[model samples]
Target chain A: MDLRVEFAGLVLKNPIITASGTFGFGLEFSSFGDLKRLGGIVVKGLSLKPREGNAMPRIVETPCGMLNAIGIQNPGVEAFLKDKLPLLPWRETAIIANLYACSVEEFGDLAGVLSGEEGVAALEVNVSCPNVTHGGAAFGQDPAQITKATEAVKKRCGNKPVIVKLSPNVTDIAVCARAAEAGGADALSLINTLLGMAVDIKTRKPVLANVVGGLSGPAIKPVALRCVYQACRAVGIPVVGIGGIASAEDALEFITVGATAVEVGTANFLRPDQSFRIIDDLPRAMLKARAADMAELRGSLVLPGQ
Target chain B: MVVRNCREVKVQSVRFLGTWDEASDFVELTLENPGWESYRPGQFAMLRPKHWGLELPWGRPFSISRLDAETLTVFFQVIGRGTSRLARLNPGDEVVVWGPLGNGFSAPPETPTLLLAGGMGIAPFRGYIENHPTPEFLRLFFAHRVPLANYPYLAMAEKVRAEAMQEHTPEDLPRIIERIRELMDENHGGIALACGPTPFMRTIQEHAVAGGLRAELSLEKSMACGVGACLGCVCKNGEGKHVQVCARGPVFQADAVQL
Candidate 1:
């Protein structure tokens, strides 16, 4: 009956949190449902300075999935703290600030700045964003860079838990997972979209203006599951799963595979109240799996001992 | 209970009004009004179409062309797969729509309104002219590459009964500006409102700036979520700040944006 989850040291009401980029500043979706009822709100990815993202046609649709290159467009750290932070109902719900920067020092500075601010329960280091020109995928793809980014964030994040969101484009997700855990990450989240591209045959041009964009949604769910499963096995810290999670059944799959929590991304675009819908449906799914609480569902996947 | 006003995205079945080929690749869709009767002049609706297990995954934004108390209409050109699928549906067939969304045009009703429309940009102005409190003070300058054969323009002109002017030579920007100036002069402090291709809108913005004519423009962007949730439909302001076109203003003051 208790749906509470300890995600990255923060006690969330439920496991369903709105993914960073999809939820905007969390204020926009208040019209759809009660923000306080959900587990948490991960406001869109923020940077040290305001980023003007890519050109037009930053998104395209594939089979049951979507590709977006919305380059972590935010109002910078100062504006987010001054304007967006106060607007959040911090007393009622968990507020996770998803942070991105072009360099290790910038990541530390952003984390440091956010640490001093009240109401920010956790810091989600968005090193895996494929949309930015630099410092995003560059930091996520390599274990060394991932370790450095994690260390930078962990150093100045104070008592706030640091969650390093891993990129799926890497060859071995486990290696990056180990690196993040080695760098003192309290928890890990995967997968932050797969680097992919779509083409418009009629125009003989790439559909997204950036040519290559990060593909998310149902199309990448399988890949996400595999990565989350691998990352969970590789690291000792808690792992949060995100990718194409539209239903309670989808969230259960992640939990069964060892993800302590899940974030709903692209589904929010279609159904704004998806987090509440998934939270509402979670109990039925857990009951079907014969699990009394969410804690029992973690790593419950039965694999054949070959 | 405090009724929180949230935009609802639903799968409502819309009956095809008519498909006009003479107008060169344009389709008009009609749907029974869902709860709310009226939206702002330049506000739009999102169409959800699925085929071959492939969907847009998000609502496709289209300006509301015409609306009655009981029904709402939208006009769109076959630009990509989304609109192509919409073109295939028949009058009796059903298509899903999420509607009456975004901040629309804002102009003082007391001022004489000059509408500059290029190609299919005439869609939103139809609703604007119809919904205006004082319709007689409205004037339209519609530009197209060829002769006027579209049913929408004719239907709009007839329904609104306002002075509608046509320009066949679309490339003649100087002449269009001159015409706008003459209309502004006649109205004694009139404002221009335009919707069209980027170049057309840009030229209108340019003229509106130079002539000191207060203007508003409706922009077109490749959108995912018609609601403000997705940061996909962002347009840069004159200050180069990224503003959500769906949340802030699909219709914005001419000088506020970079076009």
Candidate 2:
């Protein structure tokens, strides 16, 4: 059972990439499993300058999920390149940098900073983070801004494949996917957490200090699959499915629905070794799904009345 | 700086040793040790029942109340949906346990140490008292809203010089605060270690900082991953920068964190 997946100018040993934010710098989880075993590692969201993020009580647990307003707290791209990136096993696995910025030019500047590093295999443009006040879901919710941000990163990102991660908060996700495609994104990953909120009825206050946050985990799997399905049909570029992917079967569900690969997010918190477990289980899962390889299963969803 | 124990953190599926009500809502649970390195006082673990489904996605974090060669113990109150579910588990059930996590409470053996516990805040002191090299140098001052019998006061009282005070109302806080100040004065240059609700810990922090007394606080925050990766359980340090409680500490020095 070959789990290799080739998409967006990168060939992964498997379709199991740890999503940004949840997996930290990839060094934190080194004790749980071998990092080289995974297909890719999308590190924590990085910016041109270090971000302090939201105030305390930034995350709250929801039903079978969690809402987080981390605001992309990171040590900036320079710190990552100097202090963190050299320590990662990027030679064995794809180290995709997830870029977060408040402006289009800043996104390009961040991409340019990372694109020169041989360790960085790709740049994931995060215009869909719902936790921040600016340049997050604001840019993702608008198709024009999505095009502009994607184009700016593409222009400065040298030869590194640019993946536009789309938000699910918008009314029409397919339109956003098409907008990224129009701006020359090599691939698309959807959906970056749904906009949600939780309140403490006793105190009559919001659970998260940020008031609203992005919801992730098993609760959002169906929504992520729907968004990925629609986006895959709407765009010519390959789609990488993310959201609530905890097991090999969950990853296959995304692959079956037209996604070339899948990224495990919140489940990384549930079980630290979840991504490695999924990769180990994929061969058996492929056997159970009656597919010899990912290519045979990719986009194999049978529509109604087919 | 507190000397931290170097231990390998691992996740294991261990057998549940059942749970019992310690006092009213307070419950104590035991589990078979998962064969990791021995943990120190104030270290914690993330626990989730193996049978749990999507209804409860993440594991709950608890301080290690006691640990022996065969099993480990944790104390928690039924405050929310997670603990209520945890209180009903049967023996022989499998549970996913991770850690011996975070920096635990630490002080030199010869130094006189004041252990201030607020209600359920007494959980970690059991391990601390049991492991302390010189028990004569430790003093425990416990303050609670509930009856003194509702906590592990009597058991801890036998081991060290212990005192209990009841705060029946907000007005009673001054008496408790006065008692804590007296204890700090008695211990003089000794260090104060506290664990409790935010208000209780805050009071300790304020008084400890003001009187020039050295202190360490065990903070409680809702955490997703017991590791620092989630960045969910961060508290501001004295520098006003957010530091992860799960990684940097659940136990922080008096002046280190803003409280």
Candidate 3:
């Protein structure tokens, strides 16, 4: 009753889950905030092997968003399989394994390995990570490729739900949404970081060593709301909206716009306790919105005349 | 027993302590919060210079150079965007400030002390000179490389020496060992405190151990969550257990660290 949210196949206890890349794994932040209380956790971006990632200056600050080119620097799947997951104080929280690859086979191979493994409740077919150079943004940018990766993993995953993470970097996000939906994605999380960059004036250099990076924060709030609103209308599946979510009000904005759920990204870095803060504030937010239940708040927004 | 609130600060001033060619900017900050009770010489604070709407602050772990009750001094090399933007900051700009957290160098009851820092690592040494300066019980050895131009506070090295019978050496640096040995001889039984890259700290720790001197070291790690949840900032200790450099330390007893 306190913090639960319902998705297609899962009944999440709270809507306050740690977004991928930012939370690292459940092991470290457990000391700061109880990971068990989270709706779930999306661990670091994993491919087949551990990645050293880009050179120095992997992260930079924009006006309100951050440009990070860590290029998904994770200790590949095997290392994560061995080192990171076992340590989480997971309890009942859903542990979502986020997988990425340049080729369809790599996604399939990686998904095949994780499908039967312990502790993973779902597989987030990640074709939308904007930071890396190769397969990530490429596959995510094209709807055809989005379907290709989704179908590949769907063939490998037996009972697990494959939630495709969609990129807002595209011209038409719903085009990519339909592709994932068509390819049998059980669910979708929209609006990954919008690609962006900031430059230094006196020196005349681009801020990130990678030249450009994903932008996330309060600045992107409206864009995220618009994207989620449209995607929810287009898709036949649940949509988890993410972008510039900093407060309970910000989260409710996503839910009202038709997002079945929402993922808080850049805000978690500002305050480690932010997720819990949102959890505490959600019920009051529901009360303020005058919704009897969380689901009633979903799609509560109306157009000018509708 | 305590709840620390995160505060956003603005950059009031950013300037090279010496010359522009040095690429070092000592950023002065003013935030909504006044600050924590007097910080230690080697303590560091994490900062997010206004812009990077990131949920997390991306400030590098830097030592507190100088602090008046209202502001904190953060010295950084203008290597990347964070520092370059920080360099552009004039008075009245704002940033998100969190810290004065982590283990600071122990200056226990002023038994006797030797302070060493390299390059921009000279930050915390200035704090020690200002805050922990004691007359007879503690002695200091402040050394850095050439072009002691912008850093006028090297003068503080001499001031600490006047009372503690200290030795001041600003060497071209093949003489770094010679200068340190000379100071150690004059001030035996002194506790050695150091900060720099791992190798620099390792060299100082070895020298201190070889001479049977006491020492403390500050460590650095790549961190996103400075308060320790990310586990991104992990460093191997002597026991081979990976410890959170942010929560477990930025400061550790010299010999206890594996490095």
The model with the greatest DockQ is 1
Q: Which ten residues in a row have the lowest lDDT in candidate 1 chain A?
A: A128-137
Error of 2 at A140 (Å): 0.6
After superposition, which runs of candidate 2 have C-alpha atoms over 4 Å from their true positions?
Answer: A129-137, B1-24
Per-candidate local distance difference test: 0.79, 0.87, 0.72
lDDT of 1 by residue, A141-197 (tens): 878878888999999999999999988888899999999999999999888988899
Off by over 4 Å in 1: A129-137, A201-205, B1-25, B49-54, B67-69, B87-99, B145-149, B159-188
Candidate 3: where is the Cα deviation over 4 Å? A129-137, B1-43, B47-113, B118-139, B143-193, B196-224, B227-259
- Where is model 2 chain A poorest over a 10-residue stretch in terms of lDDT? A128-137
* Candidate 1: pairs in clash: none
Which is the winner by TM-score between candidate 1 and candidate 3?
Answer: 1
* Per-residue alpha-carbon lDDT of candidate 1 for residues B1-259, written as tens digits (9 for 90 to 100): 1122323322234343344454336667675554556678788876664232334566578898877776767887777777777767654444455556787776566668788788788889888888898777677777665345653677667754344445545556567667756665565477778898888788778777877778889998877777776778888888878888988879888888987
Report the error of model 2 at residue B6, Å.
Answer: 16
i-RMS for every candidate (Å) is 2.7, 3.7, 5.0
Ranking by TM-score: 2, 1, 3
Better of 1 and 2 by TM-score: 2
